[model samples]
Target: MEALLKAVVAGAALHSPLATLVQNDGTEVVLEPPANKGWVLYTVQSGDTLIGIAGRYRVDPKAIMYSSGLEGIKLKPGQQLRIPLTAGRSDREPRVPPGVEPYTVRSRDTLKGIAARFGVSELELITANPWIPSLDRLTEGAVLHIPTGQKGLLVRLSKGQTLLDLSGRFGVSLLKLAKVNGIDNPAEVAEGDLILIPGILARTTYDNLLAKREAERQARLEAERKAREEAARLAEQRRREEAARREAEAKRQARLAAQRQAQAQTQARRQAAQPATVRRSNFVSEGGYTYPVKSYVITTYFGRRGAYQRYHTGVDFAAPHGTPIYAARSGQVQVAGWSTWGYGYHVVIDHGGGVDTLYGHMSRFVVSAGEWVERGQLIGYVGSTGWSTGPHLHFEVRVGGSPRNPLAYLP
Candidate 1:
């Protein structure tokens, strides 16, 4: 063992926080703190061997040798030895108490199911039948022992039902339920495993059976409560959305109506010759503004119109989603982001002649505000953003911040 420790000291020290002790066969063991009971001092008696001393103390001989620091198996009278008392029940094997009866395991039998039926803990059942290999995988037709003295209804645990929850439903103590199932960790209990309850009968004639029915009803109520809460939350969200939509629409309509009234009043002024002070020629491009998008059919014409909406400020062009939109004419971009008032992801461009062109409902933009763009330059893509029904482009020609027909300016 000393040689083994030396061989692994370097590697083991690098990996583990605990002091590792490697055996000769390359098996490693961690050094744990001394057991709670600690060690007892005993004097070597006449004809006492290391093995015999270990047997007398019900401890491993190696533990005795290691604790005593004995180099060899040889022992002398009056030689001192330290016998370790394990922290817990290391020497004693679990046994069923008297009055327990043996039960034959039937097909599809589980340790939890057997213990629940017998009103005992799965641990107690397992403790009584030590010959059984595993708790998770029990064999059919295997004999098991029923622990003595239990009173309760045997019920299989349901999915998502916690032991604490079950205990409350059945009027059983939580600690007792945990104790019976050998469940050290309540969180680790297997779903659908049968477990025992004390003082509850499964028969319908008993009042305890009513507890089970009540529990089921309570579970259903909880589910329904959650569902209703979710539905109410969704409804509230929709209501707020509709309110916002109506408010935006009203504002848009009022703005458009004012623009139309202003236009009507200014119609006579425009009929006269162009003002000498106004440099309208500088604003006019060599060629007039072109269509922003190709292969688009006019859906909603510019002016007061539409079934759902009162006023149409711009012309709506039906275009496929992600269709490229171009600049109507050379201009500097002014606005190039989202608009909550039904004009989402729009851009406003100021052409020289107090005429600003607006493009609304775009999927994405290639240019930003304050950037110069050329005529027919790729500016954005068509999308059904804001209060649009389908993928389309809302094209507007704004003359001095007032809406104008885009078709009148476009070539």
Candidate 2:
């Protein structure tokens, strides 16, 4: 440049408008033809790169990009690019940095082919060009800015390997690796996907890495399968244990029920013995009856008490469970145990005069059936054994065999 400046002696007339700029700062002046050289409407040919196109026209790549409004666009054959024959005086060549270059994709071109052609790793090529839309496929005519960054290693992952693993093995940040591969979700990585280990030059010393990863994946799957089998076995064991427990519980309950039935049968045998001699009562029979239980509350009064109500045969005497009950009048004990009807464990006394007093809902009868007893004698205890709601005694008086209110007879 000093020689060129010295060659033009003082007062020598410079020919082009760019001469002044070139003379001012020789380094800043792009060595291209003057703007007067004019521009040509050039048809984009096959396999044309932006850099190659700018080189052919002696113009700045940025100038072409600006003129075509294709800063991050791909180039295709049959597309027209305005090729200025000369660069502007103020224009500079290689608009991008020194480590980066512009690449225009043409028809029948592929990312791999371009990468191999340029002896660059595909990962670097894609990363340096952030405008790339997808990873699996390249745009037909995308203008790529290829960055000559640190060399990269190209490796195809086998089954069960992922980008995360690649990042770990290759010492690359997961984020950087994902961005380079155009991955939105790092976990969505697939096996057999092409991986570019940035900053690592292509080599074969790490051939065993993929095999190790595959083995690890197999081990994990086997462990998971064993865990599932163990869980199933434990569940089956629990179910069997539960079934056995329930069976034992059912057997225990059956044994208890059988014992109760046998005891009831033995009690029944004590009853229905020879009838006790009927005896007259010493106490005065006020209204021809006595209160069955000593201390109680009249719960349900006998006779129709409400409209549309049925004739309540007996007066319900509410008392605590197991409260002692007495005979209403002197009579022979008729029925003395469980009554399958509404009355629970109960007793009935045939009070001789074609009248019988029924003491229902007894817990147990101390006096057996066919045994005669005087008025106010202890016969049984209060209970809710049959259809009775609570610990209460149902007391009734009868005319012939028909039920009558015991309340009318009691004092």
Candidate 3:
């Protein structure tokens, strides 16, 4: 009868076009049933609990425990649990499709502000439209072609730096800088004065002006050589013709000097038109947190694993077992405990404003649950515990009970 039951289950799994049940370690297995089945199997990882795992997956903890058959509701890494796939909908908007309308620069516009408004990065904006100058100078009426399918505007306030300093730093010409900013004179800019910097325009204008200046300089040098030859010929003629020819040679030399001065002025004007580029502070409010360890890579990610039939639920940072873990932000510890389900030792910190963080699979805990810890304070050590395949720390950030992407919060 037992053999028949097993065979029946296997047959049901194979024949059911909507779902497939795979055998797990007697206690846990994934059921990849059809979408209509409405429930899927999730694998538990180190440091996962029925409540925490349920919260991460957006299901009721008690419901998962009961449905998965928990005599004691104990979870083990690689343990599979039944989960309903149709749970919650993420609120993030769909990304804009590529190749949309180009935006022209309006008066008083900054790349940073534009990027923030469009929900895109400043780097993306600059790369999309290469014609805009990279500097903070935007001309009053200069036209800019915006790239298709970009979003966001995160404008930064202009730092009170001189045009000369900015020019050298960003490699833009003074005149191009002035043209972008609509400044008649570069010297008029005062400290604390705000200005819109155009990055692509500065680069293009500077390169073109430098090339033109070099060409003009070469032409002038060639002209001067010919003029010198002509003057020499005139001197020789005057010497042969005696005192009467001296006046004519003097007039020729005077004309050559005036022409050289005019050429010099024209070159100076061209140089003055280009502008400078600069790197402004993108931080408008408080700066974001920095990484605790100098060098650590993510070996595992937060989610469900195939082997356990449950959700993993935390980001895994690979490091030495005893590598110190620091508080990502100033927060009070909430939970610190040991378990068999995968996380051997773990700590959860509650940072105010609905932000809670979890650190799992620790070799040691420096602070007890409920203790206030400052940002960068040593909180725990990394370890290979529970269901971890190797030595690493599983980290998670939770808003209420739902898991969110950690990279979005970190710098």
Candidate 4:
């Protein structure tokens, strides 16, 4: 019965897809145990990493990771993991579609460098394997798909830079960069986002970025130079306009001086042409007024004059001390007193019709108040008294107490 049982077990092994042998003692020996029937369902326990759980099942970490589309070793407690039927059976490759190559990430290898080495675009690699969360998580010992058909390199975007800027720097077109990154609006790309540069070297990209910065710097300097030149031009224009204004003012003053001299000469001629034999009026008349002093030398004229601070308001006759001052017309003496405001000993005479005459800077009065005097009569003497700067007769002709130009009434 033992021999028969041994022969029966060996015959079963021939069809069992397993090896069975009978030793000399007629004991049945199985060469390899059969693989686990179907898949093994494992409940995640505390302190379990993906690698640890895969080790317990004698499977690759990714084998468990790919089942749930997991990226890293993060595994939750109480989670169920489905172990493949052929997980530990000589560790085989996963199923991949046609025209794709399998690659294992190694130490110090970057996703950009790997894509460049294999002449594959970083976007194509990511699309082939959609399990990776980001390019930053492409750690060592991770498996990836490399697309050998299309060739390009991968790179991450930097700060303060745009896709157009990179296109100029890396000698790439904007449309090409946008198409590879699947960007609809180039300005909407986020910083640190991954992109692909087709058929370019790493060293060449670095050199291009440097050259672009230098070109921008030169453009800024040129703009500043033009601004300074424009400011200088405006300043020169203002200076020319100011110079022209000053020259015009000087010419106007010259013309006024000439006109004043001509007026003075014409007045002197008319005064010298007067009839010297005409008899003086005994009573005040509307016209025919005479000079208060015999001398025609005038120290100051009526109206505004350069020597006085304000309008002179009267004429001034310079004479020696005690020179007799006569009245210009017949009138009654209204005042005879000393004044402090440059009008020494002054006298006022009212000649009816709102007309009056004032004699200032006098030495002494010969006529008293309310006394009637005729034209050319002795009224006072010229001397430096009160606020006088010199011995002169300050004569004024007034209408209603306000001074008028004495020359308008003088012969």
lDDT for each of the candidates?
Answer: 0.69, 0.67, 0.59, 0.68
Cα distance off (Å), candidate 2, residue 343: 0.2
On lDDT, who's better, 1 or 4?
1
Q: What is the lDDT of residue 49 in candidate 1?
A: 66
lDDT of 4 at 342: 71
Any runs in candidate 1 off by more than 4 Å, and if so which?
1-287, 306-308
Error of 1 at 313 (Å): 1.1
Off by over 4 Å in 4: 1-204, 269-322, 326-355, 360-399, 402-411
Which residue pairs in model 1 clash with each other? Answer: 121-180, 153-200
Name the regions of candidate 2 deviating beyond 4 angstroms. Answer: 1-284, 305-309
Q: 161-226 in candidate 3: lDDT tens per residue?
A: 676776666676777656655578777665433233445333345455446557778999999999
Candidate closer to the true structure by lDDT (higher is better), 2 or 3: 2
Candidate with top TM-score is 4
Please tell me which model should have the higher lDDT, number 1 or number 3.
1
Model 3 vs. true fold: TM = 0.29
Maximum-lDDT candidate: 1
All candidates: CA RMSD in angstroms? 24.7, 18.4, 54.6, 20.5
What TM-score does candidate 2 get on C-alpha atoms? Answer: 0.31
Clashes of 4: 0
What tens-digit string does per-residue lDDT give for candidate 2 at 68-177? 77866468899887655442322322223234455767667777788888877655665554334444355443566665644455454566777778888988999987
Please state the error at residue 191 of candidate 3 in Å: 99
lDDT score of model 1?
A: 0.69
lDDT of 2 at 196: 53
